[model samples]
Target: MPSSAGPSIDKITEGGRVTQVGEGQDADESAPPVMTFGAPVAGEILAERYELVEHINNDSAGRLVWRGVDVVLRRPVAVVMRYPGGDSATEMLQAAVAASRVVHPNLVGVYDAIDEAERAYVVREWVDGRSLRELVADGPLDAGRATAVGNAVASALAAVHATGMVHGNVHPGTVMISDDGRVVLADARTDGADSQENDVRAVGGILYHALTGHWPHAEAPLHGATAGHGRAAIPDAVRDANGAAAAPRQVRAGVPAYLDDLTMDLLDDSVAPPSSDVLAAELARLDVPADDDYLDSNGPLRFAAEPGEEPSPLAAAGGRKVAFGIAGLLAVALIGLIIGISTLGGESDDPKTDPVAAPSQSPSASSAPAAPAVRDLKISAARIIDPDSRNRSEVRDAEKVFDGNRDEGWSTETYPTSNFGDFKRGMGVWIDLGEERTIKSVQVNLSAPGASAELLTGTVTGQSNESGDKRVLDEFKKNRIGQPFEEHDGTTMTFNGFDADQKYRYLLFWITELPSNGNGYKVGVQEMTVQGS
Candidate 1:
């Protein structure tokens, strides 16, 4: 359950009836007739598999949120149930089914969606963290942290949009951060009432909220904001008398100019929001370094010209054939001038002893190739490499290492000793850069100091499936790249030992030892980034 600092509400469960008691409201007066009429009790088992443990709270739409357990899997799950199902529950069920189709690390996993005529409920991965709404209740996030949150949201949106669908509900409440530092976007509303463009715009809203500690979209009420409930908890954006919300920079100090511009552009009705993928890429580009001071020279994001739209003057000029023709003429004239000078000077028979110099080499005629530009490479996919584990459940949250937020990450299970309780030799996180890319450097940020890790690389082969993952893991363990980073005692590790001449596709950050965690030993990767062409 999300940790809240708000006013407490007393919940009473009697004779299978649930009543919510708030300040200044009597239990009899606050309890609606719906509470006693077939409402699910705390211990009631639904569909004979899900057993409700605790009723968390009721949403604005009167839906109940319960901390439940999947009896068969024995895993915690969040069960969202709405009463009098049938037609009223179609949208929720449909959204769950649609959300379940696309699987991404940032998006919440939809385990099961069931409608039992009288009631409908969605069983989802239970997150043991707070929402963005709760996180910002005290104040705003720093610029870098805000950017990271926005990046995670945009990445999730990109994945959702890739499947030709929209996550209609995208706000602080829907963005969940787990205890282990995983940022996940949850509770997507695929009601068709929102457009894909709107979904992208909502990411900007998320950024605004994160940076300014206020919800920007006052026109559209927040998803869980009720009349006297969650709405007041989230304050509206600070606006001028002219009815314009202040930019993030205006609201807070030290915000990067590029970030402020991107946030405002997303919220601006005049400017078209970039597609989710583009936005995610831009955010990932900005989410660098392990600190909050984002003073990078990477300027504001620029979107490509829309089809049928006029290009900028510089852009148009660069693409014109006349430009190239003029450059060619200039090159020819320069060469001719050089030749004429040489002829007028009466060149000697021996070129080495000539009084006049031969035609000077043009700048473009240089024999040396230009250096490849180093950049932050985009990771297409990532997963945990725990071949020794029986169930491989530890691989589920591997995406957190690359999710942009340095505060959130993936951790190995705690062991009695740093050597994994002497059960396994090691475990790691493997990342795929989509295709082969020039090798440069890889940075890994850990939760604590003194944990030992290594950087290894291997060629990509086999189909991108379960068998393929197994094969890749086997190959990586057998064929080590360079040498392992041994006796590492720092929280941050940078592997710049990559060969400049080599191209790498698959790389592994293998953890051989865990830092002490008081009672036991565990290690967590807060963030990981790769830099290459």
Candidate 2:
């Protein structure tokens, strides 16, 4: 609760809940539920003065989740940044803190950074809710929620761009939602080749998914190529994907025609229209049918242009609303398709620069802009919460425990069960990382062996996964990990990088020897935790 200084937990218990002393934690209606990850992070404390709740991730890059404590304040909240135990964690934390200065409401807050004894951590105001990824699967989000998600994230991007930062990872997975359906932006640390335009393209991609209930990986072009020297060039792939939408109106019916037009317009150019702040202004002012309540709740925050520019776009747009849901809509896919694996390679702990997705040749006509453009959304940033960028050295586990009940615990909904689990065990949960990072080691403690499956491990590189001009990373994980959940029977395994460029976020911990598979021992995982790169 200190402005320049943060606090530490006196006696935070494992999986316990803690309250924050601030407006964000005012009431149940106000605070989103706390999500945590298990395992005692700090030393042996009796009752977690701090509580941790776990949430499921739908991105290719694997991220561990948690909430921390104010030992001095005796409160608890969310922290978003790579766990500092892994290699490159230091550099990653530095980048995360640099970007954390980016403040906006629709965006989640970046509280403080704590680094102790050479370990690091990043904390923020926890949304205490779900994500857009979750809402899409629950059923098409009501139009209000959808628009809120779009408009809010746009506002967040505007702030990010205002500070010259970019949210490189912009999938449905990065947006966080509240219990009552408030939207917050997650992963403020997207770096390297991250840019304002990519963030815009991601917004378009998000809008497309919200409306259609389909997860779209825009086969976006990086200035025309994914090879050397071209990745920095903004890609029109998102626009191409938006344009490729079979029926914009048909997919979600009520989307204002103009909104669809805007999304499509975003995709058309290889580069983003302008800085996110500018684009945000455009979002604020663009004309829409009157009486749409979603946009009204989003207040007009100041757009940061000096003296004066043209009228704000967001003001004209009438403040649209967008809902937050974290469980991805298409986790359980009946129709399968392979996606290009992440080209950012090397599992070494060192912060080797992420291989920028090379810009493509013969760039789209729209991307040939004279300069870097920022959007004119003009929407003011929402107030999530934040602090100084101090990297913390501990991780708090999710307060909610996995009970093996498919509906309640873990992200069964996000990752899906029945078809996804291969159905051999009682319930199975797995994550597929899109990029490869050095995994120092992993430990799986089963809650109960009865339903546990064998945790399998393997490696896949970008070069190995690439096929001609395209790469199918999803296919590499599913076929390589999904199909053979049964092959990995026993215990621990160590695997290395799969590419000069890594292909996926994480290696699947598949279950091959389920009790149903006749061993009768059952597959149980009390905890599946990975430590450091």
Candidate 3:
């Protein structure tokens, strides 16, 4: 299990009812005996399948969270149990059933929801990770990472909303980051008390908490097992005398003005929040290179508006216009428009295909031919390549590098020395662009400086077997595409040595040296993006 900053405590809320469980607390003496009598014991099997292995904690709402095992499936699971279950656990069970219906990569999988006459328990996927609340316990996240988290949460909510369901819970505590760098949302309430709009606004609160380490919505306290035991775990948002929460940039330095504007706009109820999908798209656009001071290459992010609705003034005020109207069109259409104009004059002259029919080109378009589009290439799939490792587990989460998250990533096991403890040569990530694409630059974001890496390209056999992977690895090693980046001093590395005329399908980012991490050494690919059409 991932470690927490303090003693673990969980706050669970259904509808308007809130329950809190603290460490080392006994059941209340004055509470009903039925609530305390049916507490599950370690090794007890429920529904003849889930065996409780450990009592993790309890919530104030008189519910228990147990780390258990699905004896039949031999997989770890989290069993949340409430006593005297018939009527009291209806909302919880209903939420689990609803969440189970809509599957998403960022959502915790719901396995079973069972209700006995005396007690009820809901089984869910056990995450070997910590919550976002724990992550921000120390301090705020950088703009890039916070954007990534917000993007993930928005995406999850978008998935849920698509099914006409509301994930009533969207707070830091419910957002989980696994050991292999998967961001998952867990514990949906699904009670009718919350609306989809509230869920969208909660993402803003999540962004605020991530970037500023402050919970903006006082109505929803930061949920933590250890909260309220002593000093508050997370402080309320800093507000002026006028009662408006301060922007993230004001609370912390280095937060990009555009990100600050987007977050505040979401939290502003007067200015309607964009739909979950729109918010996800906007955040994905902002999840740029960590080293970038601002979004220059990708331009600004614009929140989508209703067909006739005007874009929010907050979005346009900070020079970070939401993706709407001419601005959005220019970013995507300009390249194609310019390309078409250049090719128009080159086409074989025919009276049927007159130059007058062509779209009016920019004044400078006639001066020079347009450049080919060099946008961010979408990675269809990615896998870690540890051809030399004893176990193949290191290759489990290669997608993390391309998951648009700079904070969570695929990391190598720590070694006593920088050179993989002399156990193997090195490891890397292999990315497939689905189809051959015009070669451009590849940007690799590392967790630390001083790592050495090289860029290589090769063709992938359609085979999905080990022999195919080995062949790909061999080709990558033999046909290195660019010069090796040796002992890079910075965390961001861009390999632009690819021949523009050549097309590439499979590319390998091979790391040769590890950066110093504590007394040992390890390296992490926080984010990797290939730039091409």
Candidate 3 residues lying further than 4 Å off, grouped into runs, are 1-34, 222-233, 289-297, 304-533
| Best-matching candidate per lDDT | 3
TM-score of each: 0.52, 0.41, 0.52
Per-residue alpha-carbon lDDT of candidate 1 for residues 1-533, written as tens digits (9 for 90 to 100): 11111111111001221111000111232564354555788888999999999877665556677789999999998888888788999988999999999887788889999998878999988877667776676577766677768877888888889999999888777776665555678877766888889999998899999878887877754764643453334678888888789887666543555677889999899987889988887777666643322222343364634566655564444333345457767988999999999787875777656645556668887688779898888787777776554323245456667767788687775566777767776778889899989967899999988787777778755443345656766787765655666656788888887787878888988889888877467778888999999
Residues 168-270, model 3: lDDT tens digits: 8777777876655566787788668889999999999999999888888765574433445432356788888887788886676445556777889889988
Candidate 3 accuracy as TM-score: 0.52
Error of 3 at 433 (Å): 37
Off by over 4 Å in 2: 1-62, 80-87, 116-119, 218-243, 270-272, 286-533
Instruction: List the candidate 1 regions with Cα displacement exceeding 4 Å.
Output: 1-35, 224-232, 291-295, 304-533
Each model's lDDT: 0.72, 0.41, 0.73
Q: How close is candidate 1 to the true structure, as a TM-score?
A: 0.52
